[model samples]
Target: MLTEEMMTTTEMILMTYLFEIDEWLKDKKVIQQQQAQLTKEELVTVIKNDLTTFQANQATDYEKKLQTTLTTLEALSEAQFQKMKLEILSWGPNVKHVD
Candidate 1:
């Protein structure tokens, strides 16, 4: 039951998510390159920290955002679209405002 507007917004969200995933994967490559230039223990520690962050929070956060966006998009109407748009827009400012 998604309206045209809703579908457009949802598509935008999915595209943004894909872009973020791509950037993070790129970051992984950069980290790998950095690791290659480091001594063994330093490389191991950096990688371990990155993996822990990925497992404990970053990946889970993105997955949740994507799932929620998809689930909500499936049942969207015009009013719902506007509301969701506001919520999505707010996320950025709220994040920036956080310490």
Candidate 2:
């Protein structure tokens, strides 16, 4: 039905349209690849950012816990020193001399 010797205008138009469709499909594939690469890059950036924030938060939480422990230790030391002082004072007036 198709030959170069008897080529029709309708056949020429159909061939042109087929070539255009192939070109369009190629262009679409290229664009999709580019978009996929961009999406991957953006995801990596977001993950890095989240990891940094999580590390910062962990550091801050550790520092706060350290400070709390130090404060509690200091308070206990102070209370122990006061108790010793009170006991010594109480023994002063009630101490009996061994003659």
> Best lDDT goes to which candidate?
1
Write model 1 residue lDDT over 23-86, tens digit each, in one string.
Answer: 4445421122332244323423443444455564346754444444555444555555446444
Candidate 1 at residue 71, lDDT? 52
Runs of candidate 1 with Cα error greater than 4 angstroms are: 1-71, 93-99
Q: What is the lDDT of residue 9 in candidate 1?
A: 43
Give the per-residue Cα lDDT of candidate 1 at 3: 55
Error of 2 at 29 (Å): 61
Score candidate 1 by TM-score against the native.
Answer: 0.27
For model 1, what is the alpha-carbon lDDT of residue 93?
A: 17
Q: Model 1's lDDT to the true fold?
A: 0.42
Worst 10 residues of 1 by lDDT: 28-37
